[model samples]
Target: MIDLLLQYGLFLAKTLTVVVAIALLMMAAVRARRGMGGSDDGDRLEILDLNERYKSLEQALKESCLSKKAYRAYVKAERKRRKARDKAQTEERQRLFVIDFNGDLRATEVAALRVLVTTILLDRRDGDQVLVRIENAGGTVHEHGLAASQLARLRAKGIHLTVAVDKVAASGGYLMACVADRIVAAPFAVIGSIGVLAELPNFHRLLERHGVDFELHTAGEYKRTLTLFGENTDAAREKLKGQLEDTHGLFKDFIREYRPALDLERVATGEYWHGSQAVALGLIDAIQTSDDLLLTASETTDLLQLKYSAHKKPIERLLASLQSAVAGRLAAWVGR
Candidate 1:
């Protein structure tokens, strides 16, 4: 009977402590709301209200013996509130998305850029333009071809797209630059590399010396033009050369379709030239850096960089914080 009474007294003491903490939190929230002038539900008011509610609820949980269910409920509510706030803020602004494709390109970069372009088109104003600062030395035909196709989407939407080449935009990189409505390059930038090439290594002699032999079977006559371990024939070499020429023809045609004024024969010689020479050769329109253009335009136009970044959700952050707290306490006990 005495033990039962002691248990009851402890429960009542914990309940009273929780009640006092809740009362203090409510009072603090009320004071904060009043101090904020009880304004209409604007940005500031919404933020302040969320903060107060969060603080009060957090205090209640901390001071009382909250069950797991109640803790989860509070965390969900906080997450919803934060998500709503983030959506509101994101919708309130107009931004310009800049895609900088430098060095050798990769497929992942292209995928990230596809999403970025779609988001910008949906979020930006109708008149806003996208700036692609290109500096690619050149790479595989198909790899850069896909990159060029991504840029072409902007043109399909009738959105103004500009490409600025600073250091170099050769071969497949030039393929991408030509898709832009306006092409700007620094005076000494290397531009243009209108050609295609393929290299193959043969190890038939090496394998023959090692007493190893390999045979390849193909259903089609030109299925495999060149081989690494098999002997290469003149017919195979001619076929490969024809393929490269065909690809080069397509590259020249693409440029002609976009910039009709270009002399196809002169520019398609697999040659690269500086920006000034390129401008004279009709490869680029004017000489200008992206920074200079942005600085000058900022006087009248707003310069904004549009980016879509994934951040940890509020629930995830809260869970991480809770785990960290538990770990810290466990470590402290172990240390003692």
Candidate 2:
């Protein structure tokens, strides 16, 4: 009896802790929404000079590995070489603007991507190139389309656009990648998955079992074809399936427009391939990681990493930290 009471008490405490955490999160969100105001320095275009950063890294490594005399000699020679190169190149050096897109299910990064694209369109110089490093498996259709359109904007203006994928770039991710003049990927990076998918749970039978009625009204015939509560008919199912096929048709056409050489019949099967296979399949031009590409380009070109950062309130920061902590704990627990 005592052990049972102890177990129940522990369960109650756990429940109360969860409830309090959720309540606090809700309150914080409400306050943050109400108090949010204008943007500041925290929200702006942040550019990192990859060339200087790489030079610093190289200098640090040499300083650690070489004797003081040897390091000084190396620095002197490097400065002389740089000075000579700069003197010879009296004209403006070409620039390579590097952009990164880490996409999610909603393609929220499009907000920043559009801004970066607009900025580049305004400030781009002759012979300037854009290298977008993308790490995304896939996402929603319309959102990814918007993201892809931003990349296309560069190509539209006759600016060379290169996309590098160190990881996965399947489906909607590949959609954006296809817009690039050249696509590079790490050997094992996942590529392709040109497909459309939509799914939802139906609780009609469950509600019926509980004697619950769900009434749904719509003006159009196909407007409410699929629902979570209302009974789904064969006609409704057929209509939904037809809509999916129509969407898939549009997806294939879009890819064909960008990559005309790709065999749509073979690749548009809703399947994915790694980098090497992708090359043979014409999904990617080369098998190379973004880091290697950037490092090599830094030698001859001014590499600038561009990103738009949004300002976040203190409450938002706190909430993000809390979410990250919880996610880490949950991941650890699951791993165990």
Locate the minimum summed-lDDT window of 10 residues in model 2: 327-336
Question: Who wins the TM-score comparison?
Answer: 2
- Per-candidate TM-scores read 0.62, 0.83
lDDT of 2 by residue, 129-242 (tens): 999998776768999999999999999999999999987788888999999999999998888888888899999999999999999988988888889999999999999999
lDDT of 1 by residue, 1-336 (tens): 999999999999999999999999988887899798973332210112223444576668654776777777767887898698677764433333466765353322455566667766676576777788887766678878888888898888887888999888888879989999889999988888777777777999999999999899999999999899998899999998999999998888888888899997998987888888999999999999987876555433445554433345689557656654553453233223
Full-model lDDT, candidate 2: 0.88
> Scored by Cα lDDT, where does model 1 land?
0.74
